[model samples]
Target chain A: MDNLNIGRHISGQFNEDLENVINHVMHMGGLVEKQLSDSLKAVYENDKELAQKVLASDYKINNLEVSIDDECTRIIAKRQPAAGDLRLIMAVIKTIADLERIGDEAEKIAQVALESFDSKQQDLLMNLDNLGRAVLQLLQQTLDAFTRMDVDAAIELHKADKNIDRNYDALMRQLMTYMMEDPRSIPSVMSVIWSARAIERIGDRCQNVCEYIIYFVKGKVVRHTSPDDM
Target chain B: MDNLNIGRHISGQFNEDLENVINHVMHMGGLVEKQLSDSLKAVYENDKELAQKVLASDYKINNLEVSIDDECTRIIAKRQPAAGDLRLIMAVIKTIADLERIGDEAEKIAQVALESFDSKQQDLLMNLDNLGRAVLQLLQQTLDAFTRMDVDAAIELHKADKNIDRNYDALMRQLMTYMMEDPRSIPSVMSVIWSARAIERIGDRCQNVCEYIIYFVKGKVVRHTSPDDM
Candidate 1:
C-alpha cells in the first residue's frame, strides 16, 4: 500500500476508491490462493470432500472477478484515471482474468482428486503434488509481490517459473516411463498428465500475474521478452 | 461495425479514434489467423520453413497488442467515455490479451513442426490437423463475429467451443492409445499431446474473444455461467 502512495491524493474519496479496489484485489487473490491450496491438498490426501468443497466454492471466485471488474469500470468512468492510476486499473483487470483462469485450473485439479486411483498410481499423484506445491509457492510469492508492487520480488518470482517448468518436464518424463512399464495404467496416468499440465499452467498464470505487477510498478511491458534477454 | 454504430458520436475525431482502434483489432486478428494457419500447415506438411516463419512473425502480433492497449488507455483518458463506449474499449483491451495468448499457442504448435517424426507418427499429425482445421474455422468465425459485433453470431461461436473441447478429449484418448500400443512412442506422442493442448487453448481463446463480442453488444458478462444457464 505504501508503495502505491494511495493516500497522497488530494481527494480523500479518490484515495478511498483506489484503496478499496486494491484491497478487493488482495482479498480476491487470497481466495484464489486458498482455492489452489485446497485443490492440491485435496488431491494429495485423496480428500474427495475437500475437492467437492473446492469445486463448490469456485463460483465465489468467479463472482468476485465480475464484481471487481465492475468496480474498476465504475472507477474509470468516475475518476477518468490517467497514466499510473490507469495502469493500476489495467493491471487489476488483467490480473483478475489470470486469477479467474487460475481458479479454473484449481477446479481441474480438484476433479482429479474425485477420480479413483490404484495404490501404484498413487506414486504419480505424489509427483504431481511436488509440482503443485512448487506452483503454490510461486502463487504465494506472486500475491505477496502484487501486494507490495515489488518489482524486484516480481522479477525473482518470474524466473522461478522456469524451475516449475523444469520440474514439470521431469514429472512428464517420469509419467512416460511409468506408462512404458504398464500400458494398462494409461487412462489413470493420463489424468495425472492432465493434472500436471494444469499445474504447469498455474505456474504460467502466476508468472503472468508477476508481469502485471511489474507493468503496474515500472510501466514496462516485459511480455515476449526472451528469458536470456531478461 | 454497424452494430457498433461508431459514427453516432458527436465528435468526429472520437468516432475516428474508435474506428481506428476497431480496424486495428481486425488487422491484428487477421495476422493471428495467418499465424495459426501457417503453424497448422507447417505441422501437416512437415514444412519447417513455414513453422519458422510463424514463429518469427509472432512478435508482430505482440507489438500490436501493446500498441492497441496504449491506444485504449489514451482513449479512456481523452474521451472519458461512458456506458457503451467504455464497454467497447474494455472489450478491446480484453480481446487483445486473448489474441496475444492465441499467438503464443500458435508458437507452441509451430515448434512441434520443427521435430522430425516417423511416417506412422505423421498420421497422428493428420489427426491433429483435423482438430487444428476445426479450430481455424472457429477462429475465422470468431473474427467475423467480432468485426460485426454480432451478438447472435457471438452466442453461436461461444457454443462452438464445446465441439472443440469434445474433439480435444477424443484426440487425447487417441494419443493415449497410441502411447499404450507403442511405449517407445511416449516421448514423441507427448509432443503431439502438447500441441493438441495448445490447439484446444486456441479454441478457448477464440471463445473468450466471442465472449468479449457478446459483452460489447449485450452489455452482459457470460463468463462462469454454465452452459444450461446460457
Candidate 2:
C-alpha cells in the first residue's frame, strides 16, 4: 500500500539511486522552507542583512535543483523505469521545479524587504506575517505528506491552498485601501503586495507538490480537477 | 545540425509518435498565442465578450496539456528511449508545462478584463497593448524557434525577455503614479497592474521554453545563467 516503496522490486542500484534522489529532494525542500521563513522575517523586521542572506543562499537552492534534475535524467536514461517508478521521477522533477520557483519567490520577497520604507507599517506586516505562517505550515505539511506518501494528508493540504488564496485576496483589498488613503504609502504598500503575492504563489506551489504526492500514491491525475470532486 | 531531427534515427513508430506530440504541442502553442492576443484585445477595448471567450477556451488548453503529458508518459514507457530521445521527451514535458502556465496567465488577464472600469483608461491600455504585442511577438518567435530547433534563434528569443522585464517595471511606475494622482482610479489601476504582471510572466515562460530548446539542441543547461555569459 506504500507508494514510497517504489523501485523496491527493481535492481538494488536502481533502488539506491531512487533513494538518493528522494533524499536530495527532501534536502532541497528543507532549504526552501528555511528560505521562505527567512524572507518573511526579513520583511516583518525590516532586516536588510537577513534579506541579503536569503538572496545569497538562493544560488545554493538553484544548484540543488540542477543537480537533482541531472540525477533524475541519469536515472531515466540508465534504468528506463516504468509505471510507478516513472511517475515518481516525473513527480520529483516537477516538485523540484516548484521548489526552485518557490525559492525565486522568496528571493523576490527578500529583495522587497531590503528596500527602505518611509515608516514601518506594523499592521500590514502583522497580517503578512500571519499569512506567511499559514503558508509555511501548508508547505511543511505537504512535505511531510510527501515523505509519508499519505494521500489523505496530501488531499487535505491541497484543500488548504484555498484558504491561502482567500487570505491573499483579502490582503490585496486591504493594501489597495491603504494606498488609496495615503498616496505617500503607495510605494511601501506596493512592496507588501508583491511580497504577499510571492507567498501566495508558494502556497500554490505547495498545492502542486501535494498533487504530485497524490498522483504518485494513487496513480491518478488529480490536477486541474475540481476540489469539490476531490 | 538540425536539432528538430530528433528521434529520426530511432524506430519509425517512435519517430511518428514524436512527430504527433510535437504537432500537438505546436497546436497548443497556437491556441495559447490566440488566448494572449484575445485577452489583450479585451483589455484594450474593454470588451467583456472577448474576455469571456478567452476564459471559456482555457479548458481546451488545459486538456491539450494533459493529453500531451499523457502521450509523453506513454512514449517513455513504450519506447524506453535513451540519450537524445530521452532529452527530447524531457524538453517536451517542460515546454508543455510552461505553455500551460502561459495559458493560466492569459486567463488571469482575461478575468481582469471582465471587471468593469468606471472609465476607459486609454493611455494606460494603449501602453499595455504595446507591451502585450511585444510579448506576443516573443512568444511566437520562441515557438518558431522550437519548431526549427534553431539554437541561435532560441538565444535571440532568450535575450528578448529582458525587454519585457524593463517594460513591466516602467509600466508599474506609471501605474503607481496614476494611482497617486487619482485615488479613485486605484482599484482599476490595480487590475491593470495584475494583468500586466501576467503578461510579464508570459515573457518569463517564453524564456523557459527557449532554454528547453537550447538544452535539447546543445545539451546545455542555459537556465539561471547570466545573460552576459549566455
**Number of the top-ranking candidate, with TM-score as the measure:** 2
Model 2 chain A weakest 10-residue run by lDDT? A1-10
Candidate 1 local lDDT, B1-230, one digit each (tens): 77999989999999999999999999999999999999999999999999999989999999999999989999998999999999999999999999989999999999999999999998999999999999999999999999999988988889989999999999898998899899889888989999999999999999888888888888899987776666
Give lDDT tens digits, candidate 2, residues A21-118. Answer: 99999999999999999998998888999999999999999999999999999998889889989999999999999999999999988887777765
Q: Per-model i-RMS in Å?
A: 1.2, 0.8
Global lDDT scores for all candidate models: 0.92, 0.89
Give me the candidate number with maximum lDDT: 1
lDDT value, residue B43 of candidate 1: 95
TM-score of 1: 0.97
lDDT score for residue B192 of model 2: 88
| DockQ for every prediction shown | 0.79, 0.81
Quickly count the clashes in candidate 1: 0
Give the Å shift of residue A53 in candidate 1: 1.3
